[model samples]
Target: MEVDATALAGLQSEVSQLADLFKRRLFEDRSKNALIESVQDQVRAVNDLLRYREFEGLFKEALLAIDRLQSESSTPELVDSVVDELLEVFRRRDLVAVDDSGIFDPRVHEAIGTVPASADLRPNTIAAVHRTGYVLGDRLLRPAQVTVVVSVDD
Candidate 1:
């Protein structure tokens, strides 16, 4: 039996289509997994914030955000909910460290003024954080508005 090239070409086309289908499915699966992992991370971060040891000492910023957004959209935005859920850190001096290091950050901190300090303290060191900052996971929801310090050279 003599096989024609047309039949073989048709078979090759079908195989190519099948391969593409499988490739697309694989890509979709991987993308979906990545999305799920991101959502999980956000959930975990939010959970940690919610169950913080000093829950009452956190702040009223979160609560204020919630109050403003709750009626506007009522969609349960994470930051807004946190605002509502945690509402005690407002009236006192319980500012959470925006950055682990007391480094100066112009982004979150407004350079209202600068001051002189010790030799070890370089300029832009956060001598005082006038305003507390908030974090949403790895993202900085709000930068810590602070006063930077500079070392007075002799």
Candidate 2:
């Protein structure tokens, strides 16, 4: 038996074409994989942003409780009950209110302004709290905005 020269050439051409097609397919697969990874990253970022928004909502709820207490129409007992319920929600989530009655710590407190120290008050001590802050476990959600007592001369 003998092989035809034209048949052999035709077979070689088909194999070469298949190899090129395979290489192109591999390249396209790589590009698809990269795009899939990018999309996943963007999805994760969006989820994180949504979680942050929820955290802000919690703070707003606390502010609303304060507002209710200040409004004369709302009874003190009703405001107290609302505040207690809100605090329980925070307790369940492991969110604790920051304590501002101490030496000012830059790590946990933000000094929004400074007041002249009284004869007994020490400098760098927290004088007033402008805004309440909270912490989840060891993570700081927000720093307490406070007024610091400063020496009158300085």
Candidate 3:
């Protein structure tokens, strides 16, 4: 069968133009997606900063109150009440207390000192926790300040 040369050329031209249009549309879609991702990242960063600031203010207030109570030689019951209130605030914010397991984990615990290992305690284990650590939704807010056990030989 014989086809018209002019008609064939026209069809080819239309196909090429369609291909170019598709390419352009794909590029535009990708560009738009990238821009949206960048904007979302910025918003997430801002939200994190705001959350941190809020937690910082609360912690500062709690610390000041505890300090004042100590200076005033407040009753143990009063101090306990303040501590309970602070813990409640932490719980409400989804800040969980890090467990003080005998195992020492560098990722979640900060060793401030070392103590001689005892028969009851294994070496390299957490001997004491000076300050409690907290985590919020798998994000570590603070590492637990701790003392680790060391061998007497060392």
Q: TM-score for every candidate vs. truth?
A: 0.35, 0.57, 0.53
TM-score of 1: 0.35
Candidate 2 residue-wise lDDT, 47-99, digit = tens: 99999997887778777877767775787688778879788778777888888
What's the distance in Å from true for residue 114, model 1?
A: 72
Off by over 4 Å in 1: 57-154
**Candidate 3 local lDDT, 24-58, one digit each (tens):** 99999999999999999999999999999987977
lDDT on C-alpha atoms for all candidate structures:
0.69, 0.89, 0.89
The candidate maximizing TM-score is: 2
Ranking by lDDT: 2, 3, 1
**Clashing residue pair totals per candidate (backbone < 3 A):** 4, 0, 0
TM-score of predicted model 2? 0.57
Q: Note each model's CA RMSD in angstroms.
A: 12.5, 7.0, 6.6
Give residue 105's lDDT in candidate 2 (0 to 100).
Answer: 91
- Give the true-structure RMSD of model 2: 7.0
